[model samples]
Target chain A: MYFTSFEQFINMNGHGFYVWLSYACFALLVVTNIWVAQQRHRRLRKQIKSRLGRSAKV
Target chain B: MSWFDNWHLPKWFYQMASPKWFYDFGARLQPWFAGLALILISWGLVWGLLYAPADYQQGNSFRIIYVHVPAAILGQSLFLFMAVAGAIGLIWKIKVAFMVARSATLVGASFTALALITGAVWGKPTWGTYWVWDARLTSTLILLFLYTGVMALNQAIPDRSVAGRATAILAIIGSINIPIIKYSVDWWNTLHQPSTFTLTSKPSMPPEMYIPLLLMVIGCYCFCAWLIMQRTRNEILDQERQSSWVARYLED
Candidate 1:
């Protein structure tokens, strides 16, 4: 709304590259952190489940 | 007798010390924290990037403050949180406290790195350089190193108890850098500007700019809480895999 057009908004008056790049990095950081945590949790759950299965078999 | 033993602590404090209780409580709260973080951060970033007025001097480049300040603030605060949690773990020998401390290291390190990178990028446009060895910058860099050092130390030690104690001591020692980081711009001449917010004074920026920043800061805290809870739950599972409660937890 501040910018009259979408293009102007994206351009950010010639500082667009810097602004967008910083945000990209931030997005990457957030996504990577969440993804890694979720993956670790999933892996641990699987490992525990399999271990439990083996013990029950014995 | 221990100092806390004489005092009557609240019920939630004792309940929080139990890993199982923490895991269940975290499970109940994690989704809410994550949802709130998502909503607030997106709203803040949008408002900051599009709606907030540009700085008179820095122009649109100043928008980086939204990310930079929040990341930097969270980075420092999380370290302090880690140190305090580590201290609690050391003083009380609480397993959950140690686990929470351990979970905080990676998140703290990531946010510190985020702050440094955003600061550098913002610097390129405003200060005409990507990096500087100024007091504030250097201290923040040290904070990042301190976090990594704790992580590496924990990984190097084989036994969990030993690793916990070792990292706890290291975190407490490294906490000295936090205040130094806080006062770096004041204590020494630095290219970095002074803090935008202080307890005794109002924020330097206008509400339009700072409001988004406030949202971002609170959102980041929520995100950190969600992430830390998720990781701590994982830690509890890993540590208590052999316990009967964990087995029952896995079943249900």
Candidate 2:
């Protein structure tokens, strides 16, 4: 609403590149951290489950 | 006699020391924390980027503060937290404390890096340069190094206990840099401006600008809490794999 039009919003008075770049990097970092944590959690659970299966087989 | 010998921690504190208890508690609370973070951060970012009026002087570039300031604050706070957790582990020999300290290191480092990059991007437009050798910047750079050093030390040591102790000592020693980072702008003739928010005085910026910033900061902290808890739970599962409770947990 600050800007009159969507183009102006994206332009951000010609400082758009810098503003959006910083935000993009921040968003990427947040997503990557969450994804990595989730993956690690899944992998650890899988490892434990496989170990449980192997011991049970013996 | 040691000063803490007569001191008794709360019952909940003792319960939190148990990895299985913490794992279940974290799992229960994790969704709330994550949801809160997502809502707050998204709201703050939208309000800050699209709705808030631009800075009178620096214009749109100042918007970077929304992300930069929160990242920097958390980066430093998390390091200090890591150090305190390390201290707890050292003093009480609590295994869970060590795990917390370990989990904080990676997250802290990522935040520090985020702060640095965003600061540089903001600087290019405001300060006319992408990088500076100013006291505040240099000290924050040192903070990033301290975090990485603790991480490397943790990976190098084979035994978990030994690694934890080693990293804890390093983290405590590195904590000295936190104060240096905090006071750097005041202590030296740095190009970096003084802090926007101080405890004793009101925030320098107007509510429209600062309110969103506050939201972002709180959201970042919540996100960090959620992330750290998730990682700590994984660590508990890994470290306590041989325990019967862990086996039962997996079964469920």
* DockQ computed for model 1 against the true two-chain complex using alpha carbons: 0.81
In order, the B-chain TM-scores come to 0.90, 0.91
lDDT of 1: 0.87
Q: Write the per-residue lDDT of candidate 2 for residues B131-221, one digit (tens) a residue.
A: 8655556667888988889999999999998999999999998897567655864466434445432211224788888999999999999
For B1-252, candidate 1 gives per-residue lDDT tens digits of 287668777899889999999999999999999999999999999999889998877889888888988898888999889999989888767889999999999999999999899888887776678886555566778889889899999999999989998999999988976676557645664345454322112337889989999999999999999999999999999999999888887876
User: CA shift at B79, candidate 2, in angstroms?
Assistant: 0.6
CAPRI category for model 2: high
What is the lDDT, from 0 to 100, of the residue B71 in candidate 1?
A: 90
Model 2 DockQ, alpha carbons vs. true complex: 0.84
TM-score of the first chain alone, every candidate: 0.96, 0.95
Q: List ranges where model 1 is wrong by over 4 Å.
A: B181-203
